[model samples]
Target: MKIYSYPSHVKQDIKEFIEKRLDSGTFGLLVQGDEDTIEDVKDLMFDQDDVTGNGSGSYTFNTLKAEECLVGNWDLLREAKEELQPNVDLIEKGPEFCDVMIRCYLLDWCFNKALAEIVNNTETVQKGDN
Candidate 1:
């Protein structure tokens, strides 16, 4: 299958923020919304490992952000910026990615994407209501 590679325009800090989270081991970005009846709280936990499992009734990009789900973690967004100070990790590797100032804006999008398709065929999903 095709993997989701970072767009060439993606800034280095954003890449590092996402990649750092990827390296942080198994984590799921719990996305919640109102669908079906809009009264029921629909919850779908997108595992970093499960993003690769875009098959069947399991998690797909369509389901991740679909259902008009307004999902995002304010703390993660803040931490992403604070946790990794001064983008040194990427610089040490070499000339890191350079581009526009879209990093902060796309941090939430990185949860399911960017981290998707990196792993092979994984087909399990965790969905619930809360």
Candidate 2:
């Protein structure tokens, strides 16, 4: 899930794995800065909106969005794990991809200390026409 580059799995392939069940798609990748160093860091946008178990959702653009959502709706960030179950076989499952899935969810949240949406360099385009 490196920033400004394409995602690991294809968009549609992973979409079906969680479509209508979970929000999953590499809509775009972002490069946000580290508040401490002012240096650009890689980030990604795995889901269009908050990984609401349902299809539709709103972008996280408020203060303490993650914390508030965690307290108010545990499923907000939790359902991501349950949703990605099939992506990995239960037999060979570990904490790797699941961690990516979670980070993908958390990265899109704005005003969360490190949220930047500037397109500096694009390695690939994830659109219909290039």
Candidate 3:
């Protein structure tokens, strides 16, 4: 999947724009970056105190401060594909809607990757069974 990082200052605006699209029935997913990037994003989205260590090596966002706005991470997306069977599509609304289009492309890329893995595994199993 193509990774695109928006400017830190624009994250809130981006989230708001994404929210509107989501509200209008547009399906898009926002995958978080690495641990450091996650911390940076949390700083962009919430106050300092709202982000805390989860006792594990990683951190957790306090729900009391802000609602979860971003989509699931890569692992979560893969799990969702396996368990939830999400129907994904590449949406192209043209240049005027470039932002959402990019998101759609990313989601499409990720979904296709997962689908290919599933198909390959199925074929491997079938060959073993033969």
Candidate 1 on 1-130: residue-level lDDT in tens? 2322323223233334344643332223212221331111111212222321112222223533322221233333344335444453433322111101113234335533433432221222322221
- Runs in model 2 with CA error above 4 Å? 1-77, 82-91, 110-113, 116-130
Model 3 residue 103 CA deviation in Å:
6.4
Model with the higher TM-score, candidate 1 or 3: 3
Expressed as tens digits, the lDDT of each residue in 35-128 for candidate 2 is: 4322122121344343322222232444244334334333433565566543545224323333344445443242233222222222233343
Which pairs of residues collide in candidate 2? Answer: none
Collision count for each candidate, in order: 0, 0, 0
Report the C-alpha lDDT of model 3 over 5-107, residue by residue, as the tens digit: 3222133333443344333222211232134543343343332211212122122233321112122233433443444334543132222122222223233
RMSD of each: 16.5, 15.5, 19.0
Q: What's the residue-level lDDT of 13 in candidate 3? A: 39
In model 3, the worst 10-residue window by lDDT is 48-57
User: Whole-model Cα lDDT per candidate?
Assistant: 0.29, 0.33, 0.32
- TM-score to true structure, per model: 0.22, 0.24, 0.24
Q: Looking at model 2, report the run of 10 residues with the lowest lDDT sum.
A: 1-10
